[model samples]
Target: MKSSTAQYVMGIDFGSTTSKTVILDRAGNMVASAIAHKGSVSNDGAMVSMAEALQQAGITEADIARAVSTGYGRRMLDIADKSYTEITCHARGAVHLVPDARLVIDIGGQDSKVIAVDANGLVSQFAMNDRCAAGTGKFLEALARAVQVPLEEMGPMAMTAVEHLSISNMCATFAETEVVALLAEGKRKHDVLGAVHAAIASRTLGLIARVGKREPVVMTGGVAKNVAAVHHLEQVLGMKLRIPPDPQIAGALGAALFALDEITSPDHADEEDRVDTEMAAARCGTPTCTAKKPLPANVHPLHGPALH
Candidate 1:
């Protein structure tokens, strides 16, 4: 790897179902970003996303001065200079996307979070639903399959609903059963889809209540792309949500910003030491240390472990 005091940095969000990477120049301009789907929090997904972002930016891994990571598999990235919780990163990312955003609602594949952020992009309070799959993209996927409707089309079809139906249970399994029962009772697919989105919106409102509602709310994560989800959330909140141009990359963008901060600000320069300490605490002594394992041969790391 050639290194002449790197001029770029990278941030990665290793989500449960998808991974995102963003590259930024020294000035914090986003040079490139990429997302890749995975069955779970697989390292391959992270590698693919990072590789793609690097390719797009026309830079080698060595060009990055620092790398920060977040999301489910954050610590798994051997190249990461630091790692932060999803809440911190999402709050930072959302606020960056919408400067006045006071509340951030992120509904990812397997979890949902509502964050109350300060003007300085710090999380004041946050509520998350990680215990169950309810009101998440996974829940929507299961219900979509049960309804024999394509996941992408469910949003548009739901918009045509003529009635308001209900799915009482919050459990994905139970929700699927209830959906089937609703269909058995001759409920139209459109109305059923509407109920599904409404259920998610209701659950989201519960989270928002925990953090207390704030103005200029921003919705991030993969679910933000769903029209029905956004519409229903707006309906329940009775306000329009500020969604970023690329909603799914918010965490990644936030991570990138943090990486940039670590380099530019003397206050954050010690983040790398904290990250190293945390990684040491989590690392296994086994020869195949998952935490420090290298990425696949095709992918290059920005720093740290040598890619095979």
Candidate 2:
């Protein structure tokens, strides 16, 4: 709560399954970051994660001057000074990680998107496969379970495949059935995993073509961590992909960059946010405000009512 601590900012990306958070100092350097599963990705989850990150940074919530949020749960976050789409945040995050990247492909928990970045690092055009989970991380997660491969070990297992089997279906339920049949036929787990990765890669590349792509491509999102998926995507695209240190946090980092911009830009100097406090109080008037008490410590402004 010291005056010097006011130079920090926060950004949160609350995706369907995972929520990412990034905190930056006045110089726009990352001070702390975190990712958490969505089972608690709402207010409590974000607060818990933020609290943890603050603890690591040896700071507190009062140190954050502004907070920007993005992703599916942004609206529910309530503490955000502003909200932006994942596309913008991802584009910014990519450019920060890879300054020369012209094309960015992000395959997240719920969907996949390919974005073209302009010279100024803005998103120029984009394509998304959001109608279903056909070409996304969710598909890979389900396939991993069906193939009896642990989520983190899938990439390595696929690489061990002796035969490059092909998966013709991308629909989750249908693909699950196909995998079940393959297992019944005594197919090798390695081959099944390879097929799944290849199918996802092919589908994702096709999506990129729909929006058009450029060179110096970079991949973001949780899916990018799958070495097999990245390898397959490289083959299908016939190019190399620049990957950040931790792909899952790209959205969060981008949002933090935006917060830095908003804070440092003189034009927005007076635009300090009071939204989090206003929102916490507004939601307190509801009947479902169980416990109906103020939050603990600095949490009182971020979460007003102890709703059930």
Top candidate when judged by TM-score against the true structure: 1
lDDT of 1 by residue, 1-308 (tens): 43327999899999999999999999989999999996699899999999999999999998988888999998888778678888889988888889989999999988999999887768999999968889998999899899999988999999899998999646888999999999999999999999999899999999999999998899999889999999999999999998999999999999999888877883565555556545654665656554545457675543343312
| lDDT per model vs. reference | 0.87, 0.80
For all predictions, the C-alpha RMSD in Å is: 4.5, 5.5
In candidate 2, what are the lDDT values of residues 1-308, reduced to their tens digit? 32323878888988877888999999988999988774634666677767777787788777887677887787676566567789999999999999999999999988798999999888999998857788787898888888777899999989888886777645877888888898888889998888888889889878888878688999999999999999999999999999999998899888888777766773453333345445545656586333333456653232222321
The regions of model 1 sitting more than 4 angstroms off are 1-4, 271-308
lDDT of 2: 0.80
Span of ten consecutive residues with least summed lDDT in model 2: 299-308
The positional error of residue 280 in candidate 1, measured at the CA in angstroms, is: 7.4
Q: For candidate 2, list the clashing residue pairs, or say none.
A: none
Give the distance in Å from residue 108's predicted Cα in candidate 1 to where it truly belongs.
Answer: 0.3
| Lowest lDDT block of 10, candidate 1 | 299-308
